[model samples]
Target: MPKQPDPARRSERSRQAILDATRELVSEVGYAKVSIEAIAARAGVGKQTIYRWWRSKGAVVFDSFLALSDAGEGDLALPDTGDIEADLKAVMRATVAEFADPAFSAPIRALNMEIIGDPGLAAQYLEKLAGPLDEAKKARLRSAQQAGQIAPDADLDLALELLYAPLYQRWLLRSGPLTPEYADALVDLTLKALRPSARP
Candidate 1:
């Protein structure tokens, strides 16, 4: 008798295939045009398989984007070197690089445009994409506070916004270049604000 395939491996393969299909289709046809049926066909898996794993097209696409990030270089984890400024600068620089990358930039821009036109979709996008990144930054800020790098009473949510708002404005408005120097400047300014005041 022929050897049977491992159920776990088969499931993993199916999951990866679905994600890969989603990415390719989204890149080719844009997120608004991609559908579960098309993704299932491209993945060569039954439609029920995708529905079993993801509740909607947006959820599938979100997972696909995450998988792409994982395959490329893992998630956007902030570096913790104990030097808050240096760590923030490193992450911001990486963010600039991702924004400069065509593969990442184009799809993200498409999603941003979609969100601007649809309030409901905007909320979903924020929950799926921005929410995790914001939480991670807040956690890092809290760690810095504990280390005395940041003010004990700093509002972490506002502090996080200060770190990235300029970059976001530039990207959204297409008003200026998002260079590494710009990212460094944003980090420098944010660190100056967040750092505990020196004793007189």
Candidate 2:
């Protein structure tokens, strides 16, 4: 008879399976309807298996959240094309496409509604999702400063906000179509708005 799989490998497989199941269900049904029992059944594991690792359905949904946002496979890196306008357009263009992907938007919207209702989940999302993206924005702004494209003394944090906040508002609020043209408009507007203040 074949020997039983080792515990560590078994655990890792189970974890991946659970995460995958959560992603599939949340994509199709939104986070509102996905349950621990459904996830357990989809993953071919016991409900206890899920409960043993995650304290709540929200937590599992959160992991799946990351998976889908980050290309559902791995890192969602923003490119560094060295030219601020070109680079920002490249990144934001890709981000816009990803946002509109049928596979990604619904689950994220469900998560957003959850955040609206629960302050705790909002804080959790800020920590897990928003924080890193914020840092990356700052890093991109700093790069622009170094390239002499932005004022050397610019408040990079604010600069990052100016660059990202509008696009984010458009996406989260559905205020406009997140088209490539829209993203390019943002790139132009950002560079123009941040153009070095005139010296007296």
Candidate 3:
């Protein structure tokens, strides 16, 4: 007897296809030029399929950004090598290199613009993407704190902002180069600020 296909598996495949199409269209034509009909055509699905899954083009684009960033894997943890400074420097340098890539930079910038313009989308982004990433980083910081590398009372959230805010600003404004040296410098400064004070 012939077996029937799993409807849920097929649906998931269609969902991934739509998200992939959204990413490609946005990268090729820019976010402002992408439309639901275009995404559907590119994905080999009907417009109704897209509409049924997403409330608007912005939502589809945001999901596409999430897909690209995560690669379908839910690995959000940062590396912890028992040397906080080294781990942080490695992560920051990788971030600088990623931002320097055109393929990554374009979609990331577009998604930032989309989030800035839409409050609802911004909230969703924070909750789904930024919040989880921040927590993972803070977990690393907490480990450092337990090891007495960082101040016991250090605010992990503030420490993270100190490390990353400047890099993000430079990238967003195109004001400075995103270089390994710059990333290392940021990590150095942040660590110095967060380091435990000398004891009596």
Tens-place lDDT per residue, model 2, 1-200, is 33656877889899899998997887678666789999999999999999998888877777667766554455544667888888888877887887777566766776777778889878877876676667767777778878778887777777667767887788788898888998788889888877776689
lDDT: the better of candidates 1 and 2: 1
lDDT of 3: 0.86
Q: Cα deviation of 101 in candidate 2 (Å)?
A: 2.6
- The deviation in Å at residue 139 for candidate 2 is 1.6
Local accuracy of candidate 1 as per-residue lDDT tens digits, 47-101: 9999999999988887777665532344555778988888888888988777767
lDDT tens digits by residue: candidate 3, 138-194:
999999999999999999989999999998899999999999999999999999999
| Candidate 2 global Cα RMSD | 4.4
TM-score of 1: 0.86
List candidate 1 stretches off by more than 4 Å. 1-5, 70-76
Q: Which candidate is the best by lDDT?
A: 3
Residue-level error in angstroms, candidate 2, position 71? 6.0
Runs of candidate 2 exceeding 4 Å displacement: 1-16, 24-38, 46-59, 71-77, 198-200
Evaluate candidate 1 by giving its C-alpha RMSD to the native, one decimal: 3.3
Between 1 and 2, whose TM-score is larger? Answer: 1
Clashes in each model (backbone N, CA, C under 3 Å)?
A: 0, 0, 0
**Quick one: best TM-score, which candidate?**
1
Candidate 3 wrongly placed segments (more than 4 Å): 1-15, 27-38, 46-60, 70-72
